[model samples]
Target: MGSVTTTEQDLRARAEEVLSTLAGEDARLREDQWTAIEALVAQHRRALVVQRTGWGKSAVYFVATALLREQGAGPTVIVSPLLALMRNQIDAAIRAGIVAVTVNSANNDEWDAVYADIENGDVDVLLVSPERLNNPDFRDRVLPKLAASAGMLVVDEAHCVSDWGHDFRPDYRRLRTLIVELPSGIPVLATTATANDRVVTDVSEQLDLGTGEQTLVLRGSLDRESLRLAVVPLPTPARRLAWLASKLDEMPGAGIVYTLTVQAAEDVAEFLTERGFAVRSYSGKTAPDERLDAEADLLGNRVKALVATSALGMGFDKPDLGFVVHLGAPASPVAYYQQIGRAGRALERAEVVLLPGREDRDIWAYFASLAFPPEPLVRQTLGVLSDQPLSTASIETRVDLSRTRLEMLLKVLDADGAAKRVKGGWIATGVDWHYDAERHRRVAEARRTEQQAMLDYIATDECRLVFLRRQLDDPDPTPCGRCDTCTGTVWSDDVSADGEAAADERLSRPGVEVPPRKMWPSGMAELGVDVSGKIAAGELAGVGRAIGRLSDIGWGTRLRELLGSEDRPADDVPVPSDVLDAVVRVLAGWGWERRPVGVIGIGSRTRPHQLEHLARRIAEIGRLPLLGTLPPVGEKPGARENSAQRLAAVWGGLDTAALPDLSGVDGPVLLVDDVLDTGWTMTVAARAVRRAGAPEVLPLTLAVDG
Candidate 1:
C-alpha cells in the first residue's frame, strides 16, 4: 500500500461512498461530517466534534477511516469507553467494509489475535477502551507501536477526559499522555454529545499535543426536535412506582427506563414485569452474557424496556427508540440530556419523562461523597507503596479505602507519573505529586451548581429542552414546541388506587439480610491488630436482618428522616412506634433455628436511648432477658473512614466486662442497634459479646446503608 495524495473533493466523495454503505444507499454525509473528514484525511488536523446523539458522530470516524486507509494510512485507533459501544462500532465498521477488532476487558483471549491482524494490516480500525491505555503490558508494549504507525486517533466520549464533565473517569485522563506521544502529522478526533462549554474547552486543550495549534471544534445544536420532554412529580416512591406500572404500557414504543441505582433498576423492572410488561433490569452488576442478550432484545423490540443505570449510557445506538423515562433526576442536567437524547434520534416523535423523587438529592449526595480522597489519605497510600510492587489487593490491605476508590486513586496517580502499575502490582514512582486542592474544590462546587440546575429543571415551567440546552451553554437556545410546558400538554400524575396500594405493600414488607464480614481487612497487623484471614466462625455474627436499606425506595425515606441531620436534637430520640413494630414483625418472620434467649444492645454514642429501647422491646416481646449494653472503651473514628481505619478506631473500643452475667444464657443472643452503616460496629460488638460467653449473636438493625 502506498500513500496517495487526494484533493478535498476526492476525500469527501470517498467519505460519502462509505457513509452510503454504512447507513444506507441513500445516506449522505452531513456538512459538518464532511468537514471533519476533510480535516482528518485531506488536511491532517485535529478536530473535536460536539454533536447530538445519532448526529452521525460514529459515521464521521468510520467514513474518515475508509478514506484514510484508502490512501495507505495506518488503521484508525479508537479509544472507546464501554464494551457495548465497542461492539456497536465494530459492527458499524464492518458494514462499511472496514475490518475492525476490539481489545477490551471482556476479550482478553482475542487480544493476541487482534494484535496479529493489526500488525499484518488486515484491520482497518482497532477499538480500545480508555482503561486499556494504562494497562501495564499494553502501555509498555503495544501502545508505542500503535501510536507511531496510527493513521488517525479517535477519542469517543471525550467529555469523560475532563473532570468537569458529568461522568468524569480517571482512566480517560491517561489519553493526554497518549495524545502527546502520538506521531506528528496524524489527525486526531475527539467526539462526545454531552460536553458543555467547560468540558469542550477542557477536552480540546488536552487534545492540543503542545503543538501551538488550536483544535478545530465543530459543535452543533443540542436540541432534539423529535423529543417531547415532560416532568411528572409524584409525591412519594410508591406513587412514582405505581404511576410507572400504569403508564409504561401507554408509552409509544420499546425504549429504556433509566434509574439512578442498581436496586432501583431491579425494583422497577421486577414491578413492571409482574404487571405484565416485558422489561429487564440492566446494570453494572448484570452478567456480560445477559447484558448482550438484553441489548439484543431491546434492539429487536422483544422487550418493552430496559430499566438501567448509567452503565447503559453511551455507545448504545437504537434508532427507533420511542421513549425514555427517568425514575429519578440525574445530578446534572447535561447528563440527563445525554440520557434523554437516546430517544427519538431517528424517529418523528419520542416521549421523554422524568419522575422526580424527594430522595433524589440524598442519593446525589451519597454519590458526591465518593469524590477524590483528601491529601492525607493520598499521602498515606503513597507512603505504603514501596520499591517492591504490591498488588491492588495487597495495597488495599494497608490503605483504608474501598476497592473502587483505591483503584481510581491508583489510576490517577499512575497518569500523573507518581505511580506505575506493573505485572506484579503497583509501585510508587517517587515523583513529587501535589494535590490540586483548588482544582478539586472548584470541581466539587461545579457539581453542586449542576445539581441545583437539575432541581431547577424539574421545577421550571419554561421549555424543558430550552432549560437543558441552556445548562449545556448551547449557542442558540430556543423552546422546543413539542415539550409538555411549551405545548401545554401535561402528562397525568394519576396512579390508580389499586396500583398505589400494591406498590405500598411492596415497599412496606421489609427485611434485608445483613451478611457478616467473614475476614478481617488485610494489613491489620501493621496497625498493631492481631486479626487476619478468615474470622473464627464461633466469633462471627450470624447472618442478620435489617428493616430496610438506607437507599431503598421503601423504608429508606423513613430511615433517612430518622437518621438525617434535619434535627440533631432528635438523633438520640427514642425509636418511633412504627419502627418498633417493624422490628417485632422482622423478629416474628425471622427464620432462626434457635430463638435468641437474651437481647443485648450495642452502645451508641449518638443514639443510646434508641438502642436501649429497641433491645428492651425485643426482649419483652420474645420473653428474653435484656442484657446490658457494651461499654465504650475509647473514642470511635468518624463514620466515613475506610474499613481498616474504622476497625483500628474501634478495635479496643468495646468493653465486654459491662455485660451482665451471660453464663446463665447458653443460647444465641440478639444484638440490637438503631442503624448499621459499615457493619464494623456490629462485628466488633458481636465479637465482644461472644467472647463474653454468649454462645452466638444474632444482629438486627432498623436500617442498613446499601
Candidate 2:
C-alpha cells in the first residue's frame, strides 16, 4: 500500500482498492510489499525495500498513500533521483486517483502553485530530485516546514545515499537533514533495486532517522527469471559495430544499446540509421526536448533502440524493453546490473549481452582520475573559500583544477561542513575540518576492488546471472539456467561481409570539427595578467578539424597507441602512412571558408621530429609552401589541469618570430600539431601568427585529447 499507511480495517480495504486502481483490477500487494507497508503504517517504522525492478515498489507507496489519506495524513515527500522517474511516479499516482506534484529544476514556474497545493493538502504526494533538497531557497525557507508536516518520507534510488554505492551522489546526503527533521510517527520508506550488503547497511543506517529504532529492511532475491544473459566477444570495434548493424533487427523487440561515451552512442545510432533500422541517440549532451522525443519513440516502439550512455539508465520505466547490449563494460558489476535492470522488467524473456573491449580499462581509468582529489587540491579549494561567498567559476579561475573535478571537490567539502552553498555561491563555515584520509583511502580501495570484480565477471565461466548477482552480494545466487554458460550456448563471432564492410568503412572514416576557444579564462587579472572578454575575431583560431577524437572507437584505437599515455619519455617516430592518408581526406572534405596557402608546425620539445614530418607532408601533398615552425620559448605545454594556468603558461611562450616570414604569407595558414589537449596551445599559437600578419589561422591535429 502507500507510504502513508494505517492499521484501520477500512483503510486496509482501501489500500487494496487503490492497489487495484494503480496496478490493475486483480492486483494485490506482494507478501514482502505488505510486510514493509504494515511496519510503516501500523508501527510508524522506517522500511527499506531492496527488490528488483518491476517488483511493484511503486504500488506499496501508492496504496499506502490512499490508506493513510483516508485517515487524514499529510502529503508524502519523495526524494527521487531522475526526471524520468519523477514523471513516471506522477503518472502512476494519477492512476490511483492521487494528485501528485513535483518540485524540480524543470518546473520552476509551477513551484508557487505546487507549494500552495501542499499547504492546502491538495497534493497526495510531492516528488523532487535530491539536488532540490539543498537548494538555498528551498533548504532555508521550505524544507523544514515540509518535513515537519509531511505524512511520510520516501528515498527512491536510496543506494545513492551511500559513498560505497556504485553511483554515489553527494546531494543524496541532504536526505539526512530531512529524515532527522521529519515529525515522529510519520512512516518512512527508502527503496532501491541495486545495492550490495555494504550499500544496504549504509542506507539503512541513514534512514534510521536517529530514533534509536531499527529500520525494517526487506531485501528480496535479485534473480531476474526473464533475463537471458550472454557475452559476445568481438575482437575489434568494427566487428562489434558489424554485429550490432546485423543482429539488432533480429532481437525480440525495442531496447537499449549502451555505450561508454556520448560520441559512441551517436556513432552507433548513426550507423544503425544508415542500416535502415529505426533508432535514436541519447546522452547527457542531447537536448532536453530531444531526450523526451527519443524516450517517447522507444516507449511507442517507433525506434528499435536508443544507443545511449549511462544517462539513459536508472528509473526509465520501459517494462517490456527486450534487450540491453553493452558496447563496453562498466567499471563495476553493480553498475552494470543497474543499467541492464532497465530491461526484462515485464517480459517473460529478454536478452542481455556484453561486447567488452580492452579499451574499457582506459575509459575506467579516465573516470578514476576524477575520484576525490588529493588533499593538497582539497585544501586549495577550501583556502579560497571564506565568509564572503564566491561562485564556483570565480574559484576555478584561481585553482588548477578542471570544472568537473572542482565541483566534485566542492560537494565533498560541503558534506564535511568546511564549506556551505549559499544564495550567492559557496562560503567557508570556518569549521575545523579533518581530511579523514583513512576514510577516503578505504573508499578508493573499495573502488579498486569493485573494478577488479568487474574484470572477474567478464572472465567468469559460471552462470553470468549468478556471477552478476554474487557481485551484488545476493543472498541466493543460484544458477539461472538462462545464461550462455548455463545453457551451453555460444554466439557466432562471424558477421555478414556487407555488415563487416559497412562497419569497417564507418570506423575508418575520420575527422571531427575542432571548435576554437573564444572567451579568455576568468580571473586572469588576479594572476597579474590583463585579459578579459572574447578573443578578437582576427586573433581567434578558425573552427578547425582533427583526424578524430581520442575517445572514438575507430581512430581512437589507433590514436591511443600513437599519442596516449607513455610510461617513459622516448624518441620520436615518423607518422604512419595510413594516418597521413586520413588527414588528407579530412582536409579534402573540410571546405574551409578560405584555402590555406602555407603550413606552420607547432614546435614540440619531445616530438619535434614527428610533428615536423606530418606538417611537411601535408604542405607537400597540397602543393603549398612549408613555413617554419612556431617554436616553443619555454618547456612544452602538457595537460594543464586548470584553465587559467594552462592559458598563462602558453600566453607568451610561443616564438612566432621562428616562422621565417609570416609577412609574405597572405592566406589562412594551417598550424599543425600532433595532438590538441587544452586547445590553449593552438589558441596561443594562432594569436601569435595572426598578430604577425597572417590573414587567418586554421588549426589541424592528428587527434583531440579532450
Candidate 3:
C-alpha cells in the first residue's frame, strides 16, 4: 500500500509536468482534473466528464495520454464528431509534446500515412471522426487491430451517443460496437459540456466495458459568469433584420450571428452587407475553401460576424469571442446554451442575446420532420437491401426519401446491425431488427417539449441563466446576477426608421431565377422512361423567374397562406390581387434576352382556375396572345417520391392536343404555374410545349419550393 501510494504521487508529479507544458509554466491541474487523469491512467478505469466549455476537458485527455504513453501504452484513440475539433485537438496535442494524427473525410490522402505512423508506434494519439469508424476499409482492415491495441479511447461530444441528447447523431451510436471490441481493462473516457442528467446517465451506461466495471462520472457546474444573457423579442422578420443591421455595431468585438436555416443565413448576410457591415455567410452548403477563409477572417477579427446556420456549431474554438446573437431561437434550451457557451470563454464579460422570432417554430418543425422515419419506411429500406450491396443513389431510386434523410436512416439501420455498409455500398445483414416505435415516439415528444421550453425561456421573466441551467439539470440552479432579468436591464428594442425601410425594400424585392433542370435523374431507364442522360440544351426550358422561394424569409410567409392546403377545393379560392401584382413585378424586372410573344397555362389538378386566371392576366398585361391550357392526364402525381419516379409519373401526364397551334407564334411562350416543386412538372410540361412547335418555353411561378 505504501509503494502504491508513492507510485500515485510520482504519477501526479509527471502529470503536472505535462500540464505545465500544455498550458504554460504556471499551469496546474485542478483536483477533479487530476482525479480524472489518475482514474484513467493509474486505475485503468472509464470516466465521463461533464464540464463547462473552457474547463480544460481536453487537458485531462492530453495529460492522461502523456502518462499512459510514458508507461508504454499504445496511442490514444479519440472518436471526435467534427473536423474542426479534430484539427484543434491535433494541434494542441502536438504542442503538449505528443504526436497526434487524424483520419477524416477531409484528409483521405493522409490516412495511409497516419495508419503507418500508428503502426510504427510513433503516434501518441489518433483522432477520427465517428463516420470514419464505419468506413468499410477502415473498419474491416484496421479497426480490429486498433481496438486490440488501443491504450485509451476517448469519445468527445459524447452526448451525441444518446437519442435523448439535443444533438443526437446516429454515427455515434456505432461506438457501442467499438467499445465492445476494445481490449478489457483499457481506459475509456467520454466528455461533453451540454449533457443534462438524463444524457449523463445514458452516456455513462454506454461507457461501461461489460466486465462488471462502472464508469467514474464527474459533472461540473454549467454556469458562465462572464456571459451576460438576455432575450430581445422582435415581432416581425423585417424588424429583426433592421434591429441587427442598426444595433450590431454597438456589440463588442467580433462574433457570430446564428440563424435557424441556410436561407436565413444568406438573407441576413446579404442584408448586413448591403448595410455596409463586414460579414460572411457560413453553412453546410458553403464551399470548404470558403468556410476555411471565413473561419480565418473571424479568428483574425477581420469580419464583424459570420451569419451561420447550425453547421457552425460544435468544435469551433474562439477563446476571446465577445458576443453571440441568435437571429432565431434554437429548438431546445440545451442547444441554445451550447451556442451561447461559445462566447465569454476567455473574456471577463461577453454579450449573449437571443432575438426570438415568430417563425422559429416553423423552422423547428421542418427540421423535426427529418427524424427517424416510420417503421414502414425503415422496413422498406431494409427490404430493398440484399446480399449484393447497392449504392445510396440506387437505393434512393427505389426509396422516396431525400438523400439526406435516406443517408440518416441508413446510418441508423447500419448501427443497429439491420444493414451493413460495404465498399460497394450498403447491404442487408439478414439480422432480425425491431423498430423501437415507443422510444421514437417518446423522443418526438421530448423534442416538442424542448421547443416549448425554449419558448418559455424567451417569454419568462425569470433569470435567463437560471432557467437554462435548470433545463440542463445543473446541480446549483441559482439565478445568475449578470442576466438582464436579474439586473432588470433590457436592451433597446428600437430600430431606426431608415434601417427598417432598407430592410423592407430588400424583403419586398421580388423575383429569384429558377434555372431549369439540365440533366435527367439517373436510373430513369429503370423506371421504364425512355429519356436518360443529359437533357438536350435546346430542348430544355430557358431560365425562368419566380416571386420567391416558399422557404424564403421574404415572400414565403405570404405564399404559404396563398397556396393554402393542397386538398382545398380549387374553386373555393380566387387568386389574390397582391399575388397578381407580384407576378407583374416579376415580369417587369425579368431581363429576358427575348420577350415572350404568348402565354401557355399548365393544367393544375388542384387549382386549374387559378392557373388559368394567372395565365390570362399575364397575356392581357403583355398584350400577347393567350394559348389554351394543357389538360391533366390519368392521375395527379404524388409529391413524395424519387425524382425518377416523379419524372415517370409526369412523362405522359400532360395532354399536348390542347396546346394552341405554335407555328403562328412569333417568339418564346410564357408557361404559368402556381408553384415549382421538383421541377419535373415544369420539365415535362415544357418538353410537351416545345414538341408542339413553340420556339421556346419560359416557366413562371408564384413561388419555388427550394
Candidate 4:
C-alpha cells in the first residue's frame, strides 16, 4: 500500500501492483503488512499509529484512503508541513489514480479548486501540516467545506504537539481546537516515527484520545542492526578535515556529513569537491528544486556525499545511506539520535562518526542558556509594557527593538510565561517584579544546573550508545560494537579503565594525602573562622569532622582555655582576624585540614581508626543531653549542680541595670544553642556566640555542633 490510493478496485489493484514493483528492488512486504494496512483503512474515523521509522508508516493511511473511497466513504483531509513531502505523496497518489489535492503556502489559488472538490466528496484523503490549520483563510473557508463533507483529519509529525518534544510548534497546540470544532465527530490519525514515554503522553492528551479501547496500533522494532557508531575526537579544524577525508576513502556508499551550521557544510563540501570527490552542500538556504536535485543525486550515487545541516534528513528517505557523520556535536542526545538515524535505512552495515571537541561543551552550554530569557532583557521588556494592551508593532516601538528581533523576543517571552497575547494585542503576564525576581533567579540557577548536567554527561566515561539508548528508550540494545571505546579505537585517554565504576569513584581523589602540620609549642593558638550565609545540615557535619580531628590530635585543651571562666567584656571578644589565624595554624598541624585550590576537605590519608573515632565523636556534637534540673534560684548545691545553676543564672539574670543596651538590634544574633563534642561545635558556636553578643558574636559552645 502507498499514500496514493484509488476509488476503483481495478485502479487500487493496479496501484498496489505498481508499488510492489517499485519496492521489489528495494523492500519486501508480507501479507500481515497488508492486513495491518487494511485494518487502518477500515477505520471510519482518524487513528494514530506508533511505529518505527522504516516501518512503511506512509502506506497505512494511503491504502486506507483508497479502500474507503472505493467503498464510497467520501474524502479524507491531511495537513502536512513539508512541500517536498506533499509533492512526493501527491505524485504517488496520482500514479495510483487516487484523486488528491494539496494546499500550501506556494499555491493559494489552487486550494480553492481543491476545496470545491473536497466539498463534493470527490477527493479521498487530504494531507496537511499543523501549521496550515492555523491560517485564517483555511480555517474560515477551506476547513468548513471539508467538515461539511465529513473528511478525516490526519496530522503527520504529531509529536510536534508536545511542548516537551524537541520539535514543538505553538501552532500545533491549536489543532485540538480545530479537532473539537470539526463536524461528523472528525477522528484524527496522528502519526510519528519517534516518540519517548513523555511524548506518548503528549500525543494522547493533544489528540483527545480515549485511553483504553481507542488507542493506537503500535508496531515495529526499536533495533536498527545496520547502523554502526563511532566517535572521533577532532580538537582542531585540520584534524577534523583529515579524519573526514579518511572516512570518505574508507566508506564507499553515499553518505551525509552533518555539521552545526551552513558554513561548515559549505566548507566541508567545497573541500571534498576540490579533492576530486563527488560532493555537494545542502542547507536551509538551498532552493527547493536544488535541494530535491541534490537528494536525488545522492540517492542515485551521482553525488558521492552530501555535507548538510540536520534539516537534510527530516522528510526524504534514502535507504542506502551508508554513513552519517557528525562534523560537530549535536545540541542534545535527542538531536544526535535523530541525525544518526538517517543512516543505514537499507538495513546494511553503516557507520556514524561524532567529532566532538572542547569547543562543543561551551557551544552547548551557550545554547542551553539561550533557551532561558535573560533577567535584564525581560525586566526591560516588562518596563515598556505601560500596563496597557498594544499591538506588537506599537510594543516594539516602546520596547526599543527592531521589528524582527522584537517579534523573536516576544515569542520567547510568551514561551517563558512572561507575556501573553490577547484581543489582538500583547500584554505583560510575567510575575510582579518584586516577587518574581526571586522565582526568575531560581529558574536561572536551574538552567545553570541543567547545563552542568549536560556537560557532565558528555565528559563521562560511560558507553555512549548505552547512554543514548537509555535516553531514547530504545530496547534490548547491545553496546554498539562499532563505537570508539568498544572497538578500542578511541584517541582520548580520559575514559577510565573501569567499565562501570561506582558513584564514589566518580568523586575525584587526591594523588596522596599529606600529614597535618605540627602545631608549634607556644602560649598563642591560632583559630580559622568561616561564616555561612545559610545554615545547613551538611555544613554542620563538615564542621564537626574538622573539629573532631583537631581535638583527637590534642588541640582541645588549648581551645577550652581561650573561652576563659567568665563572660568576657563586650570588647574582649577575640577579633575574627586574631582567631582565624590561630585556628588555621592549629588545624593545619592536626592532619585534619588542608585548603587545596579553593576548598577544604578532610585529609584522605588519615589513619582509619583515628578517622573512625573522630567521626563517632562528632556524630552527636550538636545534640544536647538532658542536664538535671536546677535547685530554686537561691538554693545552691554540689559543685557540678552549682556550676550548672551558675551557668543558667548568668544567662537568666540579663535584664535591667546598664546591660549592653542590645535592644532594637537588627543584625545577626549568635545563640549558644548547644555544646560541641568536637572543635567544630565550639568553633562554629564561637562565631554565633560572639555575633549575638551584639553586632557580631563569637560562638563558643561547649559541645561541637555536628
Q: Could you estimate the TM-score for every candidate?
A: 0.95, 0.96, 0.96, 0.57
Question: What's the CA RMSD for each of the models?
Answer: 2.9, 2.4, 2.1, 20.8
For 1-706, candidate 4 gives per-residue lDDT tens digits of 6564454345446436645533443444444445444444544444556555566666655665665566566576766667766776786677555777887767777887877777766777676765566554676667666666644567776766765555655666666656666664445577776666667766776565432235454544455667666666644544566556655767748889887666567666876776678999998888888888898899898987888986686566777888888877776565577677777877558877777654454345434534424567557777766446767644543343434445556654554446655555667874554325665476456445444544444565565666666555666456766665566765432322231122112111111111111221111111112222333322222222122111210222223333322232122233233333433333344343322111111211212232222222322232322111111222332211111122222222221222233333433222222223223322333222223233432222222311
lDDT for 35 (candidate 2) = 78
Per-residue lDDT of model 2, residues 1-706, tens digit only: 6464354565567667788889899987788987777777767789999989889898888787777777788888888998888888999999999999999888999999999888888999999898888789988887888888888888899999998998888888778767877787888999999999999998988888578898898998998999988888889999999998878877889999999988889888898898899999999999988988999999999999999999998779999999999999999999999998998888999999899987898888878877877888788889989899898878977777888888777776776678889998999999988887887899899989988988888888998888888888885767999899999987777898888889999888988999999999877888766888899988899989999988898888788788646453535888989999999999999998789999989988787788889999999999998877887787665556777878887887878767675777878999899888888889889888888888889999999985
* Model 4 lDDT at residue 88: 69
Worst 10 residues of 1 by lDDT: 563-572
Off by over 4 Å in 1: 1-6, 393-399, 565-570, 660-667, 693-695
Which has the better TM-score: candidate 2, or candidate 4? 2
Work out candidate 3's RMSD over C-alphas: 2.1
Per-model lDDT: 0.88, 0.86, 0.88, 0.52
Could you tell me which 10 consecutive residues in candidate 2 have the lowest summed lDDT? Answer: 2-11
Instruction: Tell me the deviation in Å of residue 540 in model 4.
Output: 65
Q: What does candidate 2 score on TM?
A: 0.96
Candidate 3: list runs displaced more than 4 Å.
Answer: 1-4, 565-572, 661-666
The TM-score measured for candidate 3 stands at 0.96
